[model samples]
Target: MTQDATAVAAAKVAGVVRELTARVMQYDATRDRRAVFAYTYFRLTSDLAANLRTNTLSFREPEWVADLSVTLAAAYSTAMDAIDSWLGLGAARPDGAPGGEVRAADMPESIPKPWRDVYAASTVRHSYVLEEVLFSMMAHMSYDLPLALRALDPAAHGDLRRHIADFHRMNDLLASSVDGVQDEISARYCRRLHSLDRLFTRDDELFTSYGIRVARGMAWFNCHRLLDPDAAAEAQGSISRSTAAFIAEFRSPDDWKRRHAFRVLRALVPSRRQWPPAGTPPA
Candidate 1:
């Protein structure tokens, strides 16, 4: 097929896949949902960033891929930071009150370091590949919950589309901004894109050939908005144990080792003094 025809076909297939993805979400019996909503928010943001990255350039350009990688890295970093900040706050406020903080000991015991590492290292300086992988996992969860809500409720689906589209339309351009001074970064990005496009596009094509794209469209409708924040939290809390189990039982060592940035200073800082002996705030 010609390039233009191919693009159109790809888009159409993606849309069908999105709809199907929404459909599959209807079957999630396990209530744990935080990761799902998180994925929806993160990817919707990623999609928005991707659009901005490619707004002026055609995908055929080698430069287009580089610009996108730089863009993805930066966007993912900022998004990850935002998520961490929020999660930090949530852990600190279990009773909905302030003052108490997220204790390190409170961290889930079985949590995979890779998952947490992905969380810790998610910075805009990196590309979207990691973000894509992380979100893909969440997308699996999203596929089951809010998506089902959309199918059963038109208002739910309509609201979701509108919200996601709006967020995607407006967000900070960290990657582009970072490239403002580093002129050669785009060149590096393009080279990486050439390699990655082959991988992602290949998977996309295989899914398409198998008629799966008509069901799980990567760049299509993205209708996960039917899930509200409350639902997501309740779902997350419910699944913490199961998620913990999956991490310990299924994660590979490669996954854990692939993501740590050497923190030269993090370990050097003085430790907190035993929480000041319970209630003694004495000087």
Candidate 2:
């Protein structure tokens, strides 16, 4: 892509990030559990957009990365827009229908399954914040990512190996974002996450970072499968099955022990005395 084209792509990412930030703020004001994931996503995308603007990572194919980011962001925004329309949240409908309303009966078939699950879980007050974040991550990384990669068609770009390298380079940003993301989650939702982080030996970070790395690796592998004529259907089916299984584990009643432990920790840790002002930029 030409320099002008890269600039255009970067500008598109910035616009999407701004829109997402507004959505996140709306969710927070409503005390919606969806805010947990929305905030995390806002931070990640903001960081990516900032990097793209500054050429901070010096990505080999910066335009491709910017375009991929925009693609994934669009998918997420589309799903959210559908859900918002269904729930009467006042967002403009994607279909341009009057009053931004979607019929309840049409909602289930309209939204992607993983996102459907995420929205359902968000309505449950007892759902774990971390699990909600993971649900969003899994939906985007495991389900949306391969499709984005396939759509971009790296082979058609240039230097396939360089594209792959740039992809793995994202893991570094993910790893670095872990602590700040956890801090934001704690500030916004659960005060006791710090204690739990200690109880888990900071393995929470290890688990999250490692899980994201593995998920991205699988996404890359699945992208290859998606590009293959014989394997695309099977690969997509496998993605759906695995994502469903992940959501199921988080929803199971058998996880009471962990929930009980969290309750205990909540009792032990003092609540945050002060929250960052609304619209404060994430660290």
Candidate 3:
């Protein structure tokens, strides 16, 4: 799709996800936070993916690019933690589990007042499972960029043709995991996501370890989120640089940070200071 077309599609998908999220949050507010978090998380990441894809300018457009990237990256980090908290993962919980005082029975109290209680229960967990598949599709894309890039002949100098062909196969698999994605998500991408999910589902521990790295890195990123633009620049510069030094067991030197997107695909872990903050939830 053209950049403009891509932006429009992303906006539409985001709106649908948000609307779906609000409805689900009202029914089982407790378990549904996971869906809400994933909804927003995918929105932000999709936004960034769009932004990153619109590299229509020079990297020297550092002022424009860095400012936006830092802010959006911070937003992505926040949404990620929110997702983990909803899932009962990360520093948001005791021992980093998302489980809390809220239980399945406690859902009604956790429900948002803005939504209709009647419609809420109907779509609770199933909606979340649907999002899990969509986000899984997204995570697959965001994470595999590096490896797919490596498979390129390297003659194209980061040209995306080969990468898209290979990575998109995974994208299709992820899309297929969602129930209606065949109608909405591309049929090709949906089929690919389903296939890839099957391949990776059995490798839970490896994925979890990778997720831990991403969460920790994001926590480090979020601690710096409230900083002003210049500071954000310096901070992201440090991160981009650190990502430079952050060797991956997988990735060639030339594409190290670019490939590190897999690590960044997971939720951001919280810094020690952000935990509980004295009166919030107990650790």
Candidate 4:
């Protein structure tokens, strides 16, 4: 696509992102732990989508991979809708609605139960920003993403490949944003220990690499599985188990080593005592 066409294509996608971002910011994710993640994802996806749309960020092939942008944005938008419904911010629809253009006609039918399971567990803000981000990634990449890819024509394997690249690119974007995201999380949920942000950075490279690899694996596996349902069924347990393990790690309050380290750090720092302090109150 030409430059003007490319901009035009991304324009619609950008507009949708603006709308979703507003919804995300408007919702008070402060009271509920789940809302923290809801807000995190909404903000993350909104930024990424807006970037991709304007060509401020470049994926493998912007013109050819435009669908990837729209589809992924739609997936995030749908999840946001799910959050709103679950939290009663908007009208709930037990049956999912594929909220954006370029989404599967039967997205509700294609979405797996695991997606809902993770969202449901977000009721308490036990997980750190990183863990919450991972949980959201698991649901979207493992469950929602495959269905989105599967909805594409099998012959369009080339398109699928580009989308996979776009997926990892977004993962890289997540890696880049970890510090900012953690700041947001700390501001909202970890007000007592925002100064210890360094605790979460030790495993940053490993975490980003692992997340990108897993997203690629899930996308490929799902695309192939769509071509062969019986084979996918045979291997379903393995897929479910792998995804379950990732989710299990984040779902538990005690899963993050950084949190433990922060506790130890807090003990060593004298001034850190008196959380919420005398004059400043917790948000």
Q: Best-fitting candidate, measured by TM-score?
A: 2
lDDT of 3 by residue, 1-283 (tens): 3455445534544443444344334323333333332333344334334433453321222222223333433433443334344444222222222433322233332322111111122123222232333333233223222222223323534333323332333233223333432222223113333443443343222223344344333433333331334454554344333321222222222456544542343223211111112222100
lDDT of 4 by residue, 171-223 (tens): 67756765566566556545643543344444332235555566657666766
Query: Could you estimate the TM-score for every candidate?
Result: 0.24, 0.76, 0.22, 0.61
lDDT to native, each model: 0.31, 0.68, 0.32, 0.51
lDDT of 1 by residue, 1-283 (tens): 2455434433443343343333223211221122222323333334433443444323332222233233333333344344345556554322222433333234443433223333322221222332233333432322322233344334553443433322222322322322231222113213242233333332222112222223233212333422455454554444333323332222222344321211222233221111112222111
Off by over 4 Å in 2: 1-9, 89-107, 154-162, 196-207, 251-283
Q: Write the per-residue lDDT of candidate 2 for residues 1-283, one digit (tens) a residue.
A: 4567557756877887887788777766555556667778888877777777766666777777778888888888888876876658453232233333233234555777777766554443344556567777888888888888888885634234458877877776776677777887788677766664565442233237787788889898888887787888999887766655666554442468865765575466443322345665444
- Give the deviation of candidate 1 from the true structure as CA RMSD: 17.1
Query: Candidate 3 versus the native: TM-score?
Result: 0.22
Off by over 4 Å in 3: 1-3, 27-203, 206-283
For model 4, the local distance difference test gives 0.51
Error of 1 at 168 (Å): 20
Error of 1 at 228 (Å): 18
TM-score for predicted model 2 compared with the true structure: 0.76
Minimum summed lDDT over a 10-residue window in model 2 is located at 94-103
